[model samples]
Target: MSGSGSRTAAARAAVGAVWSSVTSACWRHWPTWAGWAAGGFSLLYGLLGLYWTAGGDGFPFAPVDPARASGSILEGSRVEVVAPIIAVLGLVGAVVAWLMTRRARPGRRSAAALMVFGWAAAIGLTVIVPDYTLIILVAFAPLLLVFAFTGVPGDQGGIGDILYWHRTNLIIVFVGGLLWATATLAYRRRARGACASCGRRHEEGGGPSRQTLLRWGRWAVAVACLAPLPYEITRIAWYLGHPLGVTPDFLRMMQDTPGMLEVGLGCALASALGGVLTHGLVARWGETYPRWIWFKAGRRVPPTLAIVPASIVAVTIIPAGLMFLWTSEARGTWAMYVPSLFWTVWGVALGVATIAYHLRRRGACRHCGQGPQPGPEPRTSLDQRQVRDDPVSAPGQRA
Candidate 1:
């Protein structure tokens, strides 16, 4: 009985040690813990809102009668069905966020699972609430102007008009972006710490010198970045009563709409701004903060800060560009075909530039601004034997 009691005590002690370690780690990284808690709470709130909507009660902020709620062809009752699915997703996301906080590196499996879930939520919500999705996409890529202007059936409203009325979907898009960004950042952090060749902890090095490929990559990025300018200019001209390459009927239709000119002008300005930002990827300011910024001037830029958003944009735009290419080819619009090709090229170029930047910056040691220096070689057995046998003949000895 005494031996069994001792064994139980030992087990309890081991579990206590583990718990202490976890608590200590959590205390040290309290911000990460707080973020997880916030995410969980937000998800719970979303689920609650959905539940309230599903139960024939109006949402707290925006009340609508249950009979007036939109019905879904696939599920019969949109609120009743989608709310439960989203609630399940939210629960899973909350659990995953908690698990991520417990470890320094969530394994590849966890990262993959999180990515899958994030994308699923993003896509599902986009399909169900397209207006919100359109707005989010527009914010990211103004080139989506074509789709935004397309008319929706039975509503006598353009896609933009319908989206304007359904503003609640913005919350869903925001949550989806958060989930995806978190998962992606976690995965990138793990990847950065490990060596690509041996999967070992990488010591700092002056990586590859600036090569021809890198120079070409910079130029490609510049060209691709500026490619959107022509499309923007054409649209602006069309809106301003100087039609360029567009039919008179189309221009007339656009001119009749309120704020259409303003929208085109906004898209043009946004494209120009995006082009300027893209140049920073290959510029000196990309490595060291520009002097214009008082606080962060001369400070080294974090690689992930640039890489993450660029990666997301590349991933999204590449597929969209491909679809545009297919549709433009079918319609035989050479003007559209040329501009759509630029989008795909821009995505590819941005990705390449980001990779080059990472490679250039990743080699410096955090402690020293230089690559890892070679350590002194240890004496081999042969050298040791030689020194022992003839100390006088050893290097630095006078015979």
Candidate 2:
């Protein structure tokens, strides 16, 4: 029995060693793995899309009807022919990314080129196959439920329908813009070790009072985030048969789609959670991870992680709000105008808040090693009196 137990222990130790070695190797070469995986997937999907398109059977890309205004751009010709070209580009990107990973550190030119091409492919794919693209705003399904329950004639019927309409080329433009901004920042960081915008390191300065701006900005963001909660709540109540903002007929229709209620509740909860997260922008937690997050606690937050998403949300909301205004006026639903107006305000406020947060936390110059300079000391009452009395000593004294 002792001999058998010793053999089992040895086997377990060998297995553990092997697993650790494999994991370590994978961790060290993650960029190569990611690049290969992305390349393979893109190539496969593009080929499949092209093959199906040639067969006269629409298996991948959505069939476009020549009659519709939106479909006209893709009608009569296989516009999806670009899929294979994009896939080839993706493969090239993969090679570049792999090369970058192999080097001690990726060069700025290589990284920038890879980022530009990768983002272009991603945006192009999204634009070409929007129906297959996952919608981030699906979380707002509950809010849409509210409109549906209220028997709003302009309500686009279901969340899916709304997403179909919302995922336009405009989204691609915004995402591309964000990708450019992030790539520029990454390149600057890797190349110069200085702030991308200011050229100098961000350091604490006594130049101006930003406390009031930050305080007000945080509150504004919180309010803006929570603004959609009322609609969400009413929608949830309607789902539960309380019928707050809904008609009896609408309630009956809602009962047919019981799952929608759960979805709406989830969205409402998510929105509330988002409101809570907005506070992190101005709070200490934004600068450093909270204690509850054990692994990353006290670690400084990556600025791009917060700024990119916030900026994207802000940009998307502005156009969406404008669209809402136009649609509401055309449909004569004056009440809908309020949400549109508020959405624009929210977008602007969130953008300002994000900028404020960045300004507050941006580090001092890594290049010149310059930090915030001390302001000149203010004169006290006694010092002011003495200076006034001693004129020769105060100004241009001839010694």
Q: What is the TM-score of each candidate against the true structure?
A: 0.51, 0.46
Roughly what TM-score does model 1 have, to 2 decimal places? 0.51
Model 1, C-alpha of 324: deviation from truth (Å): 8.4
Give the per-residue lDDT of model 2 (tens digit) for 1-399.
Answer: 999999999999999999999997865444335544445544454464456545534332244432221221232344357445434554564454344334245567766676666656554443332321222444344565785666434444554454343244334434443443443343334344444334453453533345655666667677667666564566567667876655676667767775767766675676567667677777656656666888776566787778767765665555444444434232433232453455566667777778777665555443445545433332334334334433333445425
Task: Kindly give the stretch of ten consecutive residues in candidate 1 with the minimal lDDT sum.
Answer: 67-76
Model 2, residue 354: displacement in angstroms?
1.5
Model 1 global lDDT (CA atoms, 0 to 1): 0.55
In model 2, what is the error at residue 54, expressed in angstroms? 24
Error of 2 at 323 (Å): 2.2
The lDDT for every candidate, in the order shown, is 0.55, 0.52
Pairs that collide, model 1 = none
Which residue segments of model 1 deviate by more than 4 Å?
1-42, 49-53, 56-77, 104-115, 118-165, 187-200, 203-223, 226-230, 240-246, 257-259, 283-355, 358-399
